[model samples]
Target: MSTHRIRFLAALAGLLLLGAGGNAAAQSTITCESRNGQYQSCSANTSGGVTLSRQLSSQGCWQGDTWGYDRNRVWVTRGCRAEFRVGGASSSNNTGAKVAGALVLGAIVAAAVANNKHNDHDDRYDNDYDNGYGGGYGNGREIRCESTSGRYTTCGYVDRHQHVEIRRQLSNQQCVYGRNWGVDGRQLWVDDGCRAVFVVY
Candidate 1:
């Protein structure tokens, strides 16, 4: 081989060995405690640089009232290292609060059931009829009536210059009047006393 070619090959071999050694050094590994009863592992690969492998193992036995940090995992990179610790006790307190809330909810449900049962037993001897009718009265000159039953009609009386409302019943209908009917011609009028009516027809 020529002397220059031999020299170039030897220099190339030296450069390759240096590159391999640098790669190996870049690929560093570290281990730490996970603190959560589990192992955490990570690996990193880099171009023309070292890769990193990290493992974290822990034996969870730390406690705090409101917040705290316990020995967990520690990870180290080429330029940076970090220690991960638990500092939040809010989760444990929240869990206990949730348990208490559940118990209270259960007690409330039990009380409601007991109250319902007691009412059911007490109402057995009551003579009051349950017509399921909701009713109220109004003192205004206007009166309104509504019914879920389509067979019945509602009516009201009024004097002249006064307003009257009459609701009709369905099916065969009839009307009977015992007094003289007095009413002015209907006209559009708006006032605070205006009555509202809703009809299915």
Candidate 2:
């Protein structure tokens, strides 16, 4: 074969390998549903980052992101039907449907690996949640606690309507409320008083 022809063939092979790798790195997604076709709250796991989309605007949906999982909750204040897409990848070059499709792909790969190691634990968990077992991590709430003198501050995940109490006295300071609730539904502040309790829904 001619030198130029051989060089062309080698370049083509490299390009093919690169394209295959790119496809394998693409994201995956999964659709999540509530139990009994009705649920006050629910959650699901994912391989990568997660973003939520509602089937209908009437069905209000809320989500929280954590390591290796995405927690989703729905309220009846609007509607009852919704779904979640998991394993989304963050990319600066893509937008809209392309990004979503990649996420779905990633989720599928992750689920397969997890199933092999744990005997389909992921499937069982989803089944239990769908069947009304109330399976999930946090209660879809965030809590932040601070000391009276503003010397100490702590924040963590809390369940819905979960009561959080912090007791710490700096001198003779009483608990002073800074902000009852955060605009994003996940904040608690205390100043002056040594102890405070916050109920997050």
How many clashing residue pairs appear in each of the predictions shown?
9, 14
lDDT values, one for every candidate? 0.30, 0.40
lDDT of 1 by residue, 1-201 (tens): 344654555555455444433423222333333333222323332222222232232222121110112233222321222232222122232444445545544555555566564554544212221221111222223334322333233333322222233344221322211011111122211122222331210
Instruction: Return the top candidate by TM-score.
Output: 2
Question: What is the per-residue lDDT of model 2 for residues 129-180, given as tens digits with 9 covering 90 to 100?
Answer: 4554333433422334545445544444443333344333333555433222
- Candidate 2: which stretches are off by over 4 Å? 1-24, 35-45, 54-57, 64-80, 88-196, 199-201
Best by lDDT: 2
**Per-residue lDDT of 183 in model 2:** 17
Residue 170 lDDT (model 2): 36
Please estimate how well model 2 matches the true structure, expressed as its whole-model Cα lDDT.
0.40
TM-score of every prediction relative to native: 0.15, 0.25
